[model samples]
Target: MLIETMSIVRDIPNLNQLSKQRLDWLLAIKQQDFNTLAAMCYQSHVIPYAMIRQLRLPKSNHYEKMLPSYIIQQVNIKNITEKDQVWLLSNFDALVTTQECIIFCEELINTFNKGRTPKLILQLIQDKCLPTQNETYWYSLQEKTKDILKKQFMISSYYELTAISRILSHENTELDLGFEDHERRQIHSRTMFWSNYSSRFNRVRALLPNEIYRYIETKLKRLSPQIECFDQDGNQEQSEVFIFELSNIIVVEFLRGELSETRFFKNTEWNAKRLFDDKRLSSAAIREMSQMEVHDHLSTWQYFCEKLLRQKLQVKPNDNLPYFKGLPPAVNTYDAKIGLPKPAHNFLSERALKLERWVELFWSAEFKTSKYGHQSGLQLKSNLYLSKALIAKQLDNYEEYELFIKKAANQGNPEAMWQLGKSMLLNRKSDAKIRKYGEEWIGKAASFGHVEAVELATRFKLAFIPYKVSSSITNNDETDIKTKNMEQEKAANEGDLDAMYQLGRRSLLKKGDLLSDRLVAERWIAKAAILGHEDALKLAIKFKLPFVKKK
Candidate 1:
């Protein structure tokens, strides 16, 4: 497929935005062909969900159904050599432990790459207590050989990038599983791997010179990313694509020791603060640093890698950081196109238009005034706002975060309320400011029974009663609280045992209701017990309320 003739593939983060049945229509369009995917293979973080959704499309063609498998088979593992195969079968160990072999195998077979016999054999011996264990094998390796092993592990990390590329090809399917449980496990593994190992990222600063890297998290984002080619050019033609452009520039700046600090950390010195502020260096960084220092990701990786990164940034090798050798380079061939040149397309624009329509409806004064008449759709919109807020928060875009979170909170969203309250109180004192802006929102969220919000409210002493305490709750002129009180009293008087029990419990929380007195609470529960409310009977016994004798 020629690059120029190919239609540039705009980003489509999720195909499920439309029903699965529509994938056939997309496949029929023939726009997302092999060559049109403009984003370099590394920036394909948005491909998995698209792949999984395509796999779920019921009317998938023969080509579509078998694509994931076909892509995996493209990598001829047989070229790994007989000796290497025998070593894996006989004694060679992978970066993952024997105990973790099952998890690693699932990761390989179910999602990333599978159908290799050596990998299967390796999995088979995971529980067999091999004579040459992973620890033993690693410890026995020559320093050079150990470096090689580390490199191999790094190679394995790109497996997902390859799979995602095949997905973006829009020409493939998973051999066995698409985005099922095992795929989720792999996502979790990758996230943990990145988060747990970031401190020692300098150990493999070698990889920084490479064309691409994967985004650390974003397992469930609709228009998310996966792979990013840090050196790719001319990708920011559209205003929306600046994110991709800037992310790569950051990588470049970081690698060249030209990394600048964000304004938030301007008060801190670059000498010791850059890596900690990186929100976890990559997990691979930690592992490599640990491998070099003879300690683990959390320990030596933290202690030594910080110094190494600092020295590198400071532009002088002070002595300690100049010596450590990370593991060897990866044996696997990176088949992904490092910098596939192309332009933007309308695929994403079309989706963006659809999203724009929804956004307009959400923000329009007329639409906001008119009932949307759909609870599920409204909830989805609220959640979308919340998700945007979270993504904005990650990027330190306070304006977008505030805008989205406030929109969601105004819709009575508990999560938005919780987040909003947290934001207000995050660094501010528990003074009049919190009471004015933060406490009430947190209280509203807790009143809606959001457990985390409830906890936060309690933790910060921000909680307030949502319902007004009146002389007679059942007759009070407030909103729903009065209606609920009226309904409970009516049902209790009408001998509804469940309602009777609820009224009894409500009486204990406030002394102004129809059943407000403790004596009345006991009476109602006792009556409910006689009327066959088992829970009421239990409550009576537990509280020793007139129906059971005190032991």
Candidate 2:
């Protein structure tokens, strides 16, 4: 199945392999409706070009980026074949799409002026290529306005942000309505809510596919919750990567949803994950976020400055087309900059609540929100306490750090159990005390897949070789546990329900991420649910994990 999924993505025409893989995972889960699938494919198709533009800004200028469009305009190859033009339009490059859309609209206007309205053909193109609402959203199409709606929808469709910006900047035949700008106003007023084409996705949550939105959001949860500071061990790379990944994810899954009510920090890596346990600190974070971008004693684009710059930096696909007939621009390959977030601000706008939760745990002494607040949706994740213990120690609060470590151990955190046990081994005065507590806690940790705990327990005569400590194996150290994982893999490959049950538990160790690959882990757990692994089944059902096929 995995190989089959890989093959599906590999066959996509021009997308790079990495992008194809990302899009494949996002797209492989069949939605049952081809319209939804088409929307997903279209979004996935557009993001690479969007990312390329974001990446190109730091080192280049507008002229360099506009090179592609300039060449197309200048080269006047009057006898270009229709087949060649179709291929050029289908390049899937943002700049190429923009130019083609313009040319297409112009040709349509010309044909209309020649006394022919290809309404059927235009309607098909609008239905397929335009960014549009899901069919369910249109409550009713009035009999009187249906014809006008079609025309307005056609004039409203555009290929890129650049296209909209260009059309709005000045008068052009493509944007002009029979040489009058009044058509633009009429098209904007005719749409359901948007006053402009670029604003179509601004309120897209209503049109987004529910299942895909939840799925991508689940992935986003895994990537978020990192701590970032400008000078310290900041999460600049992770935050940047996340912003890039998220924009692509939303466009493909959530339809470029709004951020006016979301955390503004979503796009910025600098001080992104700062804790605001302190009131002064919370105020400080808000102030920093509120501050506008400044350049050499001048306020430029204000809070929007970074977003503007990145859009400018993106590599335009104008001259890079193969048919242009020249060595590719000296630099700016799609590989060099595409979908990387230099500045994450274009996608952000609300206050982050995650850091407050981190701070809540950070202050073990406070122990606020004793059993978890339902409103916050914060849960005690596996190894979370152990991670907090490490942070506590870093803050030099060793006294409370031990307390936090023990808390994690009590919560069945394998790392905490193993670590607390190791600490006892070194600190306890008597051998009996050392052996008693050390073996107990480490044994518990070993049951959850702590390899070192397994080795330690084995050396202390508390466990056997291969460490099959649970009814389900936990330690996944291939060297020692290879036979078991292989056996499970074999049984799983052959569709053995019992094997899936065991593998699911094994993959679901609450000790560490080293044991967790949520997609694979969830799949195993979901498979086991069919065989009735009680806890695994509960979570699988809750998460709506995909059920694997039986042999």
The candidate that wins on lDDT is 1
Task: Give lDDT tens digits, candidate 1, residues 418-485.
Answer: 88887777645567776467777888887765656655555666755633344453433345555667
User: How much does candidate 2 score in TM-score?
Assistant: 0.25
**After best superposition, candidate 2 residue 363: deviation in angstroms?**
14
Where model 1 places Cα greater than 4 Å from the true spot, the runs are 1-380, 429-431, 455-551
Residues 427-487, candidate 2, lDDT per residue (tens digit)? 7464886767877898887875675676566556675223344433335433345665786
Query: In model 1, how large is the Cα lDDT of residue 310?
Result: 35
Judge candidate 2 at residue 151 and give its lDDT. 54
Number of colliding residue pairs in model 1: 20
TM-score of each: 0.25, 0.25
Instruction: Give lDDT for model 2.
Output: 0.39
**What local lDDT score does residue 483 receive in model 2, on the 0 to 100 scale?**
67
Local distance difference test values of all predictions, in order: 0.39, 0.39
Determine which window of 10 residues in candidate 2 has minimal summed lDDT. 252-261
